[model samples]
Structures are given as C-alpha cells and as structure tokens.
Target: MCVWILIGLCIITKVHGYSDGDFPQSCDSLLPEHRRSGVNILPQNTKPPYKVTYKPGNNGEPITVSLESNPGHKFSGFMLEARETQRVDEGPPVGRFISLQPDTRLLTCSLSADSAVSNRYSAGKTLIRVNWTAEGAELDITFRATFVESYAKFWERVDRKVTIQTTTPPPTTQPSTAEPSTAKPSTANPSTVKPSTAKPSTAELSTTNSSPVTTSISSSTTQNTQRPDALGLKREGTVQMSLDILFVGVKMELPNIITITITNSLFSRGLIKVSNILCSLLSMAVEISAPILFCANDSCTVTLIALMCVVIVINFMDLVIVSLPIGPSHELKDICDLAAKVCSVIHMVFTIAALFVAVLEIDDCRNNRKDFWLLKVMTAFTVWICLFLIWTFVVSIHRNEILGRNKTGSSKWREQGKKNKLSAAEVIVTAVSVILIMGTLSFTVTVIAGIFLAKQTCA
Candidate 1:
C-alpha cells in the first residue's frame, strides 16, 4: 500500500506540471528601441491648423487655430515649428514642449478619455505646428499646420441677398399754339375761268379733298391693326380642317368607325388629311361587300354575285392549266407530280376562300351574328389546314426517310406502296402531331377570343 500511494502521487505531480507548462501568461512586449523608432503616424484628431474658430471680418471672417492630440495618448511635451529643408525653412518656431500628465484618479481626465484632445485646443488666428513625444518614447514627431474656412462663411455666400432698382421715364409735355389765319381768295380766278365751266366754292373743294384723305388713312390703320389676328385665325382654321380630314379617312378604313372616332378624339391631337383619304377608301371597300358578300346566306350565292368574280375566273383558269398533262415520268416522279398538283389546287382554293371572306368582312357584313360565327370557325379551320399543309410539305421533302425507304421509288406502283405504308407509322406521328396541333390551336383560339373581347369593350 505504501508503494502504490507513492507511485500515484508521483503521477499526479507530473500531469500538473505538464498542464501548467502549456498555459499562456504575458503578451509579447516591444523593446525601448522598437518603441523609439520614427514612424509616419497620421494624426487621428488633428485636421490642420489643428483647430478652427471664426469671427467677423470686413470682407469675410478670420479663422483661429489650436494644436492637440488624439484621445488615449498623452500630450507629453510638444514643439511648435515649421518644416525645414535644404532649400526652404517656412514653418513656426520651436517652443518648450508641454507635458500632459494624465491622472487616473481625476474626474476631468476620466470624462475626457472618450473626447478628442483637439476639442480642448483654443481657437485663434495663429497657424499651429505640432510635435509630440509619447510619455516613455524618446523619438520626436511633427505635423504640418493648416486652416479650414468656417461654415458661417459658406452659408453667408450661399444665402446672400441682392436688390435691383429700375427708373421710369417722366411723362411727355404737349405744346400749346394759336390757330392759323385763313388765306384770302384770288380775285382773278373766278372771272378768268371759262364761262361754260362752273366754279366750285372753297368750302366744297376743301371738304371733297379732305374726305378721301381721311378715309384712306383710317382704312390703312384698320388693316394694320387686324392683319396679325386674321393670320392667326387662318392658321388655326387650316389645322382644324386637316384634322377633320384625317378623322374622316380613319373612319373609312376601319370597320369599327365609332370606336375609332372615340379613340382618335381621346388620343390624337391634330388632323392629318392623307390619313383621312386612305381611311375613307378603306371604309368604302368594307361597306360595299358587307351586305352582299360576307353576310350572304350561301357561300355559292356570294361567290356568284360578288365583284371577286374576276378572282374566281382566274383561279378556275389555273385549275385547268394544272390538269393539262405536260410530260411522262417514272412512278415516284408521277406521284410527286400528282401531289404537287393537289397541293397547288389546295393552295388556290384556300387563297380564294380567304380573299372572299376578306372582301365580305370589309363590306360590313362581319357584324352579322351568324356571319361572324361562321368566319371564326372558318378562320380556325384555315389555321389547322395550313399546319397540315406544312406537315405535308415536310413529309414530301423527306419522303424516303419518313417511309423507311432506302431510296426513291422506281415506279408508280412502288411509290403508292410507300405512301400506303405511311399509315403504319401513324401512331407515333399522329400523337406528336396532335399534341402540337392542340397546343397551337389553344393559343390561337385564346388570342382570337381576347381580341374579340377587347373590341367589344372598346366599342
């Protein structure tokens, strides 16, 4: 037991010694030489002339200066001196350095601990130079002096008031004069004048001459006074007339004339005559077809009766041209030629139908409830048919790849067989085509509905 107890004590002592050795004590300290080394330390609280105070002056104000240190540092003793160099010595003199011995027990120093030393520096006109040595450090440091303008001078200039005087000219004075004497009549004039001629009296002659002169002067003055105002009125009238013409033209072009008129009145400021003429032509076109063509009870009836008879005749002529045979070819080439003919016919039919509808809609028949619904449906069908035609075009261009053929068909019978086999790949193609068609159809229908709703609301 004595041996075990002795071994345990020895182990405990060794552990404690190791722990104590690992623990930290004092921080790293700088030597006196290191502290005394000169460094370019920037002043914390000293923005040079170190301090500033302003008092009134004849032109402006004078600024005063004080020198001080940053907080947490002692003032120690300081030298006030200008910077000296080999070429120039233009700074203040060196003075006895004052010591700032801070007493920890003093309340003033304690309160001032948080305040900057510059706050205690007196404000005066003298330029301040500062050199400070820290309490324990032997090296000397210096800062150049400067002066800052006061806020009062800045504000005074910014808010300065000015006065101006204007003199009025004195009223003019009119001269008073006596009336002129009347002239004596010439004695020989009445007798010497021809006996057959009648002699006019002086009063009559004077009145006749004066009347024309007075009238001419009055007319000239009136024209001069009214010319500017008359010109202004004429300009205004011309502008208004132009605006009226523009409005008329727009009404002619658009189907919804009333809505257009209201919109123009609300948004447009002036008239444009060219716009009016164009709109009028468009309106006439729309009005002509509305009742007879677009709103007709039967498509065949409108097709026969409408002015687009010329277009119909041309399309018929094209059909005839396509049907006529030009040359013989292989089976695949024959099928391609046949497809081209069918595509051309389809395109012609679609174009004729579109033109017919457009002409009828322009005439104003689009406003009819039945006609409008028919048109909407026709438009939707047309869009779908266009998509189908595009797909057909793509399939035609890549017929071999789509039909899983290694090369083009050599004969008409082989071409027919390949086209027939297309039905076999329908499941995949149809699914993708349907998805694309449905997405496009939904988007188109939504847009058309929105347009219709906006038109209705605007109307």
Candidate 2:
C-alpha cells in the first residue's frame, strides 16, 4: 500500500509538470517541417525579412506597394524602384523607372500602373523592387515581385463609359414654319360697292385736331413762363425765393453741426458703455476678493460695501451721460440742455453719497489695515471720478457758450476777449478755473491707470 501511495504521488507530480511545461511541444514539433522546407524556424541576429506586396495591372485602379519587416524588428525605411529588371539594372534590362525614399518606419508607394507593359516582356507584368533597412541590423533586405491582375476590373469599364459619354452629342430638333393660306379674297365692281362711305367718324376728326390744339397751348404756356428753361420756374422772383429758402435750410443744418453732434454722441456713448461694463466687472471682482484680502469681519464687509457704493454712483452717472442725445440741430441742443440739467442733479447726489461712504469706510478701516489701504484707494478713485465728471460738464457748458456767442455775433470769445478784457479779477478767475480743470483731468487719468495696474497685479 505504501509503494502504491508513493507511486500515485509521483504520477500526480508528473501531470502537474506537463500542465505547466515551459517548452511547448506544439511549436517544437514543427522543426522537421521547417527543415524540409529549408527555411530557418528561428533566426537570431539575422537580417530582418523584408517582403514587398503589390497589386498589379492597376488592379482596375492604381497599384500600391508596401514593405513589412519580421516581428521583433522595427520597420525603419524603404526604397522603391520600378524597373524592367529585378537585379538593380543588371538582369533583363530596365525600361522606365521611379524611385521613392520614405524616411519612416513603414513605407508605402502607390503607382499608377495603368501604362501598357512592354511587348518584350509579359503583357501585364511589371517588376517592383524594394530595399528595406531596420535598426540594429547589418544586412539590408530586398523584395521583388511581378504584379498581375488580382482585383475587380471596374476602372476600365468606368473609363470606357466616360469616353463614350464625352464623345456623344445631344440631338437637336428642326423648327417648323407656317404654310401660306390657300383661300382667295372676293373681288367686286365699283357699282356693287355703291356709295358705301360710312358716316364721317368723329374719332378720326378728333384725332386729326388734337395735335394742333396741344401745340398751340404748349407754345402759349411756354411764352408766359418767366423762369429759365433749366430751372423751370414761372418767374425770376420765384427762383430767388426758392434759393433763399434752400440756403436758409442748409445754413440751419450746417455740416459742422451734424458732424460735431454725431461725433460727440458716439464718443460719449462709447466711453460710457465701456466704462460701465468695466466698472461693474471690477465691482463684482472686488466683492469676490473681499474675503481674500481682509478677514471675514464686520469692518471688512463695511469697507467693501462702501467701495461698491462709490462704484454704483459712478456707473449711474455714466448711464445718465450716455443716454443724452446729440443729434441734428434743434434736437441736439434740446438734448444737450436736458443732459446738462440731469448731469448736474446726478453729480450733486453722487458727491454727497460718495462723501458719506468715504466717511463710513474711514471709520471701518480704522480697525483693519488691509481695509484701510483698500478704502484709501477707493476714496482717491471716487474723488478723481467726481472731478472728471465736473470737468466734463464744464467743458460741455463752455462749448455751448462758445457756440451761442458765435451765433449771436460772428465773433469768437477768445479773440474778442483778447482784444477787450482788462479786469484782473476776471483774469485770475479764468486762470484758476483752467488750472483746476487741467489738474482734475490729470489726476483722474493717473488714478485710473494706477487702479488698472493694481487690478492686474492682484490678478
């Protein structure tokens, strides 16, 4: 029994070894067939096998050739040559040839192999040669083949159909003409016609008389007209009156009036729209960044709210300014007047609101350093924007004044003032006002630039 048990254990071990065996017999047993064929079953450190595959006879179309390397060897590149001979111009003799060099891992060449084969060789035979080289291989591989028909002949039939269609012309029809009438007209004597001249037709008489009467009326009217033939006026006085009215209308709507109105309207609206959008986005961004810059405290939120209030005022002012119309003549003047009034009201309101917000922010920022810096910047920006608004209003008012004075008397204020001004108080007031306006514009521009830079840096 012990011997039987030991033998059984040994049998189990043998079965396990066979199940997990490394040397697979199925492949190893094919060595004899490989030897009989004289082909290497496994070649080590040998040149990779290069084979060229081509479809011939145009295959009813173009012929494409590709090169494939043996497994475990990468396809580096290939050179393709179409020649009459197979051995590099040594055998048979080459006719027309084309060579291709593809510096790629897999190379392919498609030849329009529709040309007739030379009679010296087969009717539809062409020799394709491919030389391939792979990385880490010493010997280059060469592939050769003679292509023949191996695909459906569709292109030939298509070509024949195209040729027939191109050669054919459309059929045309000949036009038919009407035949002459065969019936003859009846002939009667003058006696049979009897005195059959119908009663005198009023229509014919009226037609005959119409032309002379119309001509007489036209001549009389032409003589009575007093204007030149070119202007078609009844009298010279009427022509002068028409010219006066035309000139007056043109003067009322002068070119400069229309141009300046359009330019100012577009400029103001464009600036307002752009500034509003930017300011709104900036306000939202500041709100979002409040927590990051300052701790989530009461004072920080107050400061942010104060800053946002100032932005709201500025945005409101921009909207009001943009809504004003600057257009043709009277309409533009009316709009300008309305805008000036609305602007003055809004400016006063914004100024008061901004001052209140600035005071609140200053109080809030006393407890937070970050909030203090932010509020300080906000205060400066608000003051700058207010000053700019005021300066713009002053410029608009001044322009209106200049236009009004010019219209009243065709004299400019600058020239007239230079000639007549003599008061020191007036000169001092003018100098101070100009300086203030210029200073305001410069300060506003500088603040705007600084704010833009700060935002960019923070971003």
lDDT (tens digit, per residue) of candidate 2 on 1-459? 999999999998876342221222221121111232555333223333444564221102212344443454332212233332223223221222221211111112232221111111112222222222121222222223221122211001000001001111111111111112111111234543322321123334445445545654564344234112311211121222222222212221222233233335456445544543443344334333432332322123343345435544543554455444544254465465445345433533443343334333222212222543444644664564466456445644674453433442223534556534333433443454455445544543443343334333222
Full-model lDDT for every candidate: 0.31, 0.32
CA RMSD of each candidate after superposition: 37.5, 37.1
- Per-residue lDDT for 1-459 in model 1, tens only? 999999999998876332111111100100011111454222224332222221111111111112433343223211222112221123222212221211000011112221111111212222222112122322222322222223111000011111111222122111111112112123435544432122334434546545645654564455345433323322222222222222222222222222222334323312322333344343234333433333332212233234334433433443344344443334454564444335333533443354334323222211233444434544564565466556645755675565454443233434566433324443344454555445444543443453344234222
Highest TM-score among the candidates is held by which one? 2
**Error at 268, model 2, angstroms:** 12
Off by over 4 Å in 2: 1-325, 328-332, 344-352, 359-404, 407-434, 441-459
**Native-structure RMSD, model 1:** 37.5
Model 1, position 78, has a per-residue lDDT of 19
Q: List the residue pairs that clash in candidate 2.
A: none
The runs of at least 3 residues in candidate 1 whose Cα sits more than 4 Å from the true structure, single-residue gaps closed, are 1-318, 325-372, 406-423, 426-459
